[model samples]
Target: MLVVGAVVLAALMLPGVWHLLRHGLTIVHEAAHAGVAVLVGRRLSGIRVHSDTSGLTVSRGRARGPGMVATVAAGYPGPALLGAAAAWLLSRGYALGVLWLLLLVVVLVLLQIRNWYGLWAVLVSGVALVAVTLWAPAQVQTVVAAGLTWFFLLGAPRAVVEMQVQRRRVRRRGGRDESDAGLLAGLTHVPAIVWVGAFLAVCGVLLAAGGAWLLAAWPVTGITYPPWADVPTCDPMCPSAASATAPGLPFSVCDSEAVSTPPEIEPHSGRNESLSLRRALALLDVCARETDPTGLTAAEIGRRLGVHKSTVLRLAAPLLESELLRRDTTSGRFRLGPGALRLGHAYLSTLDVESVAAPSLDELARTTGCLTVLTVPDGLQSRIAGHRPAPGTAGRAVPRLPSVVPLHCTAPGKAILSVAGTALLERAVAGGLRPVTPRSITDPGELRAEVLRTRRRGFAVDDREFDPDVRAVAAPVLDHTGDVVAALAVVGPAARMSAAAVQEHARSVVLAARTVTRRLGGAGLGPSAAAGGAAEDLRARRGA
Candidate 1:
């Protein structure tokens, strides 16, 4: 009688228990976003929390561009990837395994909490669970069982659909390819539906198993059974001796907790300490090659390191302070900092800089039928880094010479200066904006305004501002962090390059800039820009 009563109680509380489990998954998801945001130097926005859902807070002020797009795309992939990881961890039974599993689930839930609709689903489910746990009557156990069964049937399918929709949206927005869309999507693409079908079938089995376990453990009556007597047996009727086996044993047993048990004496704790340190170093190596760290979070780092977020923070503290990594004040994004810059410079010094850019510049020249020049920012001015002569224009053509020029007076120079902000512009002015030509912009204030406008438009044009009859349009080449690091320009005769002609070629110039950017591993324009350009390119290519 007591065993039957216990089963009824367990059955009644199943829904609430499931909701509780989901809450932890939510936390892990949000933490992943917040961690990545912090790593990229984005501002920490407040977190939003409900019983079963949570969202990591972030805001980008001032700093807007490809970096922002990367950060937004980072959130969706965080959960599903982490969930798989946690599932693996649970299977292995690492230290504090159950807690880790819970954390992973929370992360999963938080990752799903994108809009109000998702938030509502989580909140309502959480409330239902809490209500059942605290105040549900004995007879209500039947209702709880039915509710949990229904939820497993309906909710899991809904989640799968929602995940697909979210992944498609991310791809449309130009995020990293669907490779990171998680296991489900990957399974969906298989020729045989077996993969997806197997996954769903497994989920169904787990749900059924869990439901049966609860139902047999908690009945409508209030009687109770000993914990040992509730353990599940694989063979129900093998023998009378086997009949001693418990019915709800799995409910009380946590796979993660059992697997993660520490050694009795904490053997070789000091030796193991070095393992985390080595792991940290390895992680830094991976991060070094990454052009943009805006989408990285502490939790994401944890996932990469096979450790916890707290551990990642502890390990990264020194790197952060030394400016090997920088935190973006506006968006709270992290990126390689001054130390990394110095290291990159030291490495680059060993190579011939122009050699790296020559082929790309030549390609630009051929495509645009205009002299192409690549320029690097020098103090107060820019030096031509590489140049290629226009196609089809022979020896009789006016010679285009490379010279150090005031940043405000030339297209490539202005394009680079536009991204450097006011302080750099002021320094350039202090050095003196010598009038290179009659059309030269000599006033520092006017030049500053123009640069601001150019930055807003993501490119710059010089209509014989550097030298009369020399008309050009240029776009800035950004580094991994989206800072303008170099410039690319197409220069030609002003008379031949009318204003309308220049405007028409702007798209070409920008496209070339994007190509160079991708080659250099930098993020390109936002989704809207890419989508619009893709449509235009499709039309152009089809016509051609």
Candidate 2:
């Protein structure tokens, strides 16, 4: 198995065999140029991917502006940078996020693919990713991600070599130079060789950094072993605070003098340093969750985070001064402020999931005469990222739903939860299911069974479980890494969303989910036959 894996990895790295994979890198390369152009306020005209592993991203902006320079510089380093980013996300357990990001990039690029071949290439690749994301197991997703990272890291430098050859050819032919390196050289008054060197430097650094990160992320146990087998190692000799300090000491050791011990082996100090950083990050997360109309006070924040009010105050002080959080003078309550809004906007602006799914959502809402909603997973819960109302529904009564919904009750919530592993599900329901209605599944075992049923059926149903009158059916949206990033649901009143209506709407909802998944670059539909079973499921449910 190891030898086979080595062979596969080596094949993916070799340029001769690697051309089979170069299309993806080419798309990323062109997308990087377009992304940078748009980020700098340039108008992206279109993108063209050629059969020769080259692509062009055309943008309109100031002729001699920084945007042009950045766009020119982006092409050669794009794939390497993207691969490094994927490695970084994987290292931090953001594999699904990376997949969704890549899928978004591809979908964005597809909108501008100027040729039939380019469209075909992108569509096929996207479909493949969707299939893997929706059907493949988590381990397969990891391998697919790692393979992509390796291909990009190893393939980028070779492309630089090709650029150098192209430069020489252009010189011999006295042809108008067109390669990205040549264009960059012309723009910067730098030699083509120098541009090539810069490309090499960037690709080389990414290769080394990404490789090291992937190695570190690799488990000590064999790949076949479950992730639980790879236990986190901790320092056995690290002394507890109670054991390290004298038994009769009255004063707390949290003071500055606590570090008066020998510097050579202050394990307690090292732990404190680590804890300080972790506590700050945890405090930020706790505060970010305070989107409630009534902001949380220090006392409430401390209680929720399992810390003392003094500790919460101390931790919040830096955030308050940084303006990442706001405090109400009258009530001493804290909420996310302008700085957090800026951060949220920055992230949302880059995430193309909402943009890609909007059209499908509109169509689904129109076709079903039901409410269409997109929900993205946020920690243990799911948040309504986008909402679409049915056509010609103005002035009609609509069901009100919370922006944040627990993973146990709603259709969209359960759809996302179904894709999460048992460990994550357990963690999500640890506080127990909050009943939104009398029919809500509060028992952990029952909820687990329901999630499993959702997995089997490829859709989740909330038949007045979340709200007494609201009914919904949701399908999980998978990204390129086979992780469920979001859910798409069609919701309506229980009277209209009868068993037959659910069966009918369920098809459209699942299809919309699949469309979003494909747009994001997930592809394997044949193996699962998710849609093929839709009719059969509807028949069964209607009979019941």
Candidate 3:
């Protein structure tokens, strides 16, 4: 088995086969960067595993810091660390566990893929793992698992050596392009050769240790009396953290760390009950985190949950029956069904409108150089539920919010008046369209005409109506039922909001309102058809 494994590893490392096989290592390398980036408080944007066997992980955080250093440094050592882990698991008779664990890792990495080739490469790798773990016979699984353990243990150091040679060539050619080692060198203010040596040293140590474990696991022929055969193995449902941490195992029945960690339960409920609950929730959490509408296959779930498809069937049966999960007839994948929508609605229902619109208000205020407000209808009037002054505005000088403004004069008021339908318009007519300034519409027929114009575009523009020197643009924020919940508006001095600028601010105000709508699980007046008659309105404003 050892000789066969080495032969296959050597064959794969050849110039021809290595080109393709290297992609798996590249996936691990990039995934390592992403995993560490999350751990270090960076927001990961995406990862791309290229066809050239190169990879990139993009994350946002401080450009220079230990976190950045750690993220960059993780790539080269990742495969070796994973191999060491696999070898450790195998030595304990957890060959099946190793395969499942690798499958889980692959599935997690698959979620971060950013390109078509990255998607294709990861999907192929994940499929191969799925086939081997589920379809292969037991003996085939054991041998294949052992083979992979050896490959990762052997391949990692060789990759580092190759990187050094490639880096040297780049230096010789006077190229400024840097490898991970070069990046590390610059990060630490150390020489590039030192970082290269550090990478080599760590990989070599892990390789040696992993190799010893793999060698020891090989069965001896004609050795029925062998002392090692008598040793017992503990496949971990390691009930205590002490035993789990005693020697090599990294996980335990004792605990999990995320929202996936089992919740506290009654003492009488029993461990199996808690374990079962944790498994179900973890499954849902995985599906929910992925935004793809296509959902995940049963094979993908099995890989993700580290359970057999049979176990997925068992757990998912109740969820499907309850309508929390649904099986797609066309794709044979599982997706969160209508019942999950209740849970989402419940969550969104608890969110305060002011809290939801606050960020958008702040952002709009800065970006538009104006006051931004969230306005909601109260009786026949509009109230400012939230507002933020422009960046340079005096904090104490601006009026406090949650304040009232007329329903027919201001932009936000008109926006709400337009979407609140004809009933609200009639109510406004009964209450009277009191002019706030000379430019405010007071004529009932003209007020009706203005409402029609606001409905035509997705936004309403106030032309020195609320206050003679000020102008505003606003858009209605709608709930899922198409009810106007609020309006998002930007207010500025008339000089800054010229007819040309009103066109731009109109789109921005509409976009900001749509953003709040999305966050609240609400819908908006479809796309703003604000280009043609809108231009005529702008020209009319220019003439006025």
Q: In model 1, which range of ten residues has the least summed lDDT? A: 252-261
Full-model lDDT for every candidate: 0.53, 0.71, 0.73
Tens-digit per-residue lDDT, 1-544, candidate 3 = 4774678578676997878778888988888899999999999999998888988999999988999999999988888899999887775456677789789878988888899999999999899999998777545676777777777777777778888899989999999747898888888898888877888888899988887776654431101111111111122122232232211111121121333332343334557766666677767766764558999988887776667778777778888888888899898889998888898889877887788889899888888878888888888888888888888877458854548888888889888876676667777877887888876889876676576567654567777777877778898887756678899998888766653466456656866887787677663453232233244434433443
Q: Write the per-residue lDDT of candidate 2 for residues 1-544, one digit (tens) a residue.
A: 1332366468866767767677888898899899999999999999998888778788898887678899889988998998898877765444555667678888999999998778988998888878766676545666676666677777788778878888788889989878887777788889877888999999999988987776654431112121111111111112232233211111111111121122244345648665555555666666654548668888887766556789788878888888888899998888887887787667545657788889989999999998899999998889999988877879986667689888899899888876655556767678678888976889776676566556555567886788877778898887755677889999887766643467567667876887787667553232233333333434433443
Give TM-scores for every candidate, taking all chains together and pairing residue i with residue i.
Answer: 0.35, 0.41, 0.41
- Between candidates 2 and 3, name the one with more favorable lDDT: 3
Candidate 1 segments whose C-alpha is farther than 4 A from its true place: 1-353, 397-400, 481-483, 524-544
The clash count of every prediction, one per candidate, is 46, 11, 0
lDDT of 3 at 233: 19
Candidate 1 accuracy as lDDT: 0.53
Shift in Å, residue 312, candidate 1 = 20
- A best-first ranking of the candidates according to their lDDT comes to 3, 2, 1
Query: By TM-score, how accurate is candidate 3?
Result: 0.41
- What are the clashing pairs of model 3? none
Best by lDDT: 3
Model 3 spans > 4 angstroms off? 220-544
Candidate 2 regions exceeding 4 Å error are 1-9, 12-16, 220-544
